[model samples]
Target chain A: MNPVELKYNKEHEYAGVNGNIVTFGITNHAQESLGDVVFVELPDEGATVTAGKSYGTVESVKAVSDIMASVSGKVVEVNTQVLDAPDLLNSDPYGEGWLIKVEADDLSPLETMMSADEYEAFVATEEH
Target chain B: MIGTKRTPIYEEHQAAKAKLIDFGGWEMPVQYAGVIAEHHAVRNKAGLFDTSHMGEIDVRGKDALAFVQMLITNDASKLHDGKILYSPMCYPTGGIVDDSLVYRYDTEHFFIVVNASNADKDYAWMLEQAKNFEVTVDNVSDQYVQLALQGPLAETILQRITQVDLSKIIYYTFTHGEVDGVPCLISRTGYTGEDGFEVYCAPEFGRQLWRKILEIGASDGVQPIGLGARDTLRFEARLPLYGNELGAEITPLEAGIGFFVKLDKEDFVGKAALQLQKEQGVPRKLVGLEMVGRGIARSHYPLQKDGEEIGFVTSGSFSPTLNKNIALGLIRSDLAVQGDVLDVMIRDKAVQAKIIPSLFYKRG
Candidate 1:
């Protein structure tokens, strides 16, 4: 089970908002689906991202998939650790596997995202 | 849409929560726990794989040896009972139709396992060749299910459920035995480069065999592997896939599988063309490549030398064993050398790559 503080995108990304900056990473379910994460091309700091748009690319052992942004914001910080050790996404997706920190353009987008409980139910439906 | 065929263990895979994918028109399990985890399970302990999607054809009659010798590039007469031979079924123009494993049950009976996608094509080709000989070819693909128990501890784990003395079953040889009173054909052959066995049995009895093996080997870390890991493992071993490595355009000699082709054999479908190629030397050869820089090389990716397109990648993946991006490509014989640097264009970027010898992983 994941922590309750974070919000999830329909695409399986988890965003934890704290003040004006929001930290985001892929959920455990997403990591499991992608298999072993081999490489991560993170968006540059200060890059603007729009909701539901491709923010970066994540390459797994099998194929490369685009990482869709869940919230509109400007990238404040990029996780260099994930670029070096992409397996962190598989091991600690919610914590150390955080991909980037974004300075939110508006906090209203968070309301559109599913809460932890709702995300779990959403994942359950997907499994069926 | 192509009709996706289901294997005998299709339900078993679903019950185990395996990720199913359409593999060559077969609804096969691509992964269970995960590709890497399942791959490691096979490498370190044991893994059970449902390989029922692979086609099995039985060739039986008075002239089975002669029939096979005329169909495949390998000499079937050399194979004794229980012995297996690997070879390519080629076209008259020196192109590979399919690569398969032939098991000689006796002088007049032989079983051949070909790739699933090439079942109809391979069977038709064999029938065409067998028209003159007293041979009857039967496609028994749906009648049987194949389960592969691979890895270091595969033998020890399998021995617990079976009565056969697996130790006596040498490599490339098979033995008919019973696992839980169900008759099975067990052979010490695998695609993972590790020591393992492939079990062939009736479709109804296959489920029981899978359950028994998992139940007995669960304590020892035996896991259900899928086609995803199978591909990665085989790729790391540099095992050629039919459509990728040995295609209609590529000859087996040029694919680095000349060891399996019996040039001295009296005659075969592609003997003349292969002999000519052997005498004149093949123009192109398949080689392994290791990415030296960022970006992954995939199938059909253009390989360039000094900005000139030389060849294209056939099969590639991020190798879990090597922790690097690796690929296989057919390049001009002169360019297929070890330590030679090349550029692989991946999404408009020329990633630095180095050509290497085949087989990224070797059993220690």
Candidate 2:
């Protein structure tokens, strides 16, 4: 998982933007902290997602966590692989575990997102 | 770790890169490799657990048996030497003080193991109750550490490191033995609903014994389990956890542990209240819930019948062995029948669930 290319939300979500199609997923650190994901409740394609709002949820045996959006947009694609095999979030969080693709309403939020270094430092101060 | 206590195996857990969590004020490992993996290992092979945080109390005196009888809801007379009894200590109102295991070594000596979260409160309650009897209750929690190696292969794997005749030790019975030169109380008991042993030894030797058990169990797929899996395993077995299933407000009869409560016993603490509840019919009953709709039914989630609140979930999770979302709920006894559809509120939305028998999984 390359951290350099990713922009992070304080809520532990990530955005990988290529043109207007931005990919959304929980970060590797988030998945590791969550343990094995048993189920995922994701929004269908064409659903709207707002920056800093919950777009979906990821659940493990012990806990349920909201997956917040980093970029506001209408969802273009939903990763059915993770919905079918949720452990992809634990095993390959950066690649196969990507949750949704969105055509950005505005890419402005991307500039405000934390870099890998800043995100790591930010997480260090928050209590688990 | 500021004010929380640490068990002797704290270092071992750190060495394993375990994720530590504050469990009942004790800095314990919640998981090592992962919760789901460790859970599967226990169900299929064997898993060793560091349950050293459990509290131990020793009661001694000529009136120990009689005293125990008065304190617990179980029939103490049924216990003989080398036997164990699961009982709930209760308040006069029939509210649970805590659920504990009583190991009867003799008429004058008994060992009680209590939940870690309720240890201090239980000890205080015991001490207060001791004023009525000649027995002396000593909180010997600091003197020892406890470990459970559980699963289908638990017996075979444990037999390699201990000289104890594992075959002779029947369920709910205990014996003394030395494991790899360390003195221990080898009890054929476990919370995981598996055939296994609970080894209690001095705290200083806890790490050595823990490592040795894992090392010897390496080839057999034995792994170190954490609290996450332990709870799930016990829940699947319909074991009543203190705060979850049994509490100061929940009676034993309602918790579905009535089998352990000998209401016919001459007398015990809360006997009058429990007897009355039994005669009147238990108010709320614990039942199993299988999610018919999306979302897991987590603890404290409201359960409803036709939009009216019926009860709440005590414990809920995705069962590793069962491979689905399941929960143990305490609901009105009238609506607690099997196959009844109910609503479990998850995030203010009502999700459909069906009531089922409490034991979601049982060993063959």
Candidate 3:
């Protein structure tokens, strides 16, 4: 189960919000499916991201996948640690593995995203 | 994976919590512990694999050796009893039908192991080629289950359970042996870049043998490896996977396995075409590449040079052993040389990659 406080997107990205600053990372299901992460490419601070657009990529041993944005925002910070040792996404996906942070102009788009329960259900349907 | 074929050891894969995928029409595990962990295990310690999905065929009769010699491009005359020869069986046009391991049981009998997806096709091709000879071609895939115990510790781990003298089975050789009271053929041939052995036994004994190997190999740090690691392991060793590195449209000369082609041998199915290609120079060369840019190169990605697309990648991945991104590509032979840089079209980006020698890993 993912942290209940975060909002989820169908692409399996999780967003944790505080005020207008939101921290983003991939969900546990995403990291598990991607397997051992080999490289992570993320947007730099001050970069503008849009809802549903790919902000970065996560490469695993088997394949590479895009990490989509949950809401349009301006990047505030990036997790440089995960980029150095990308397998942190596999070991601490929800904690120190957070990929980036963005200052959202309008947080209402977060309402459309899934809660932990809804995301869990979405992952369950995908497994079958 | 609905309606896909399942091997005898399917339940064991599930029991180990492996992630299963449909590989060549068979439901097989792609990974168990994880790709990196399993990849490291195979490199540093040992790993076990359920290769029962691999297909085998039996060739028997008075003309067995001649039939095999004519069927494969390699010189099967060098094969004595208990020797294994790796060769590509090509069509008369020089295109490869399949690459197989020819196990010479004797002059009158031989066994061939081929890719799982090409099992039926390889058999039909063999049968079609058998009409001119007094030999029997039988698809024995269903009768046997093949398991690979690979790595430095493979012999050390397996020696604990078997009575056969492990040291006698040299590389590229095999012998009929007994494991845990079950009759099996132990082959020193390994696809991964390690010292290992393959065990072929009856289907009824597969589960027990698989369980027994894992149970005894636990202390030596052997784990059940899946196809994901199997691929990375073999790729690191510069071995080709059938569909990626070879196909019906690809010639053995172009696929960089031309060493297996014995041009000096007697006339065979692809002798004429391959002979001409060898003289005229192969159209393309399979070369190794190391990614210099950020993205990882994947299969079928265009290989471009000076903005003109020349060829495509046959296989590519972030190597767990080397800790770098690498790829195998078939490009115009003129451009393949050590230190040449090429562009791998990864998605919308043209990533710079350098052509390197194919040697990636070797056991010490």
Computed on alpha carbons, the lDDT of every model, listed in order, comes to: 0.90, 0.91, 0.92
Is 1 or 2 the stronger prediction by lDDT? 2
lDDT tens per residue, model 1, B1-364: 2678888788899999898888889898889988888888888899999999899999999998888888888888988899999889999998998999999999899999999999989888888888899989999898988999999999999998888999999999998999778999999999998899999999999889999999999999999999989999999998999878889999998899988889997988989999999999898888999989877888889989999988889899988888788999988888888999999998777988999987899989
lDDT of 3 at A24: 91
What are the runs in model 1 whose C-alpha is more than 4 Å off?
A1-7, A15-22, A46-53, A70-74, A103-128, B1-3
Task: Give Cα distance to truth, residue B304, candidate 2, Å.
Answer: 0.6
Please report, as a residue range, the 10-residue window in candidate 1 chain B with the lowest summed lDDT: B1-10
- Whole-model lDDT for model 1 versus the true structure? 0.90
* DockQ of each candidate relative to the true complex: 0.63, 0.77, 0.80
* Worst ten in a row by lDDT for model 3 chain B: B355-364
**Sort order, lDDT high to low:** 3, 2, 1
TM-score of chain B of 1: 0.98
Model 1 backbone overlap count: 0
lDDT of 2 at B217: 93
Ranking by DockQ: 3, 2, 1
Off by over 4 Å in 2: A117-128
Question: How well is each residue in A11-120 modelled by candidate 3, as lDDT tens digits?
Answer: 88899999999999998999989889998998888999998889989999888898888879899999999878898899899998999999998898899999999999
Report lDDT (Cα) of residue A104, candidate 3. Answer: 94
Candidate 3 has a TM-score of: 0.97
CAPRI band of model 1? medium
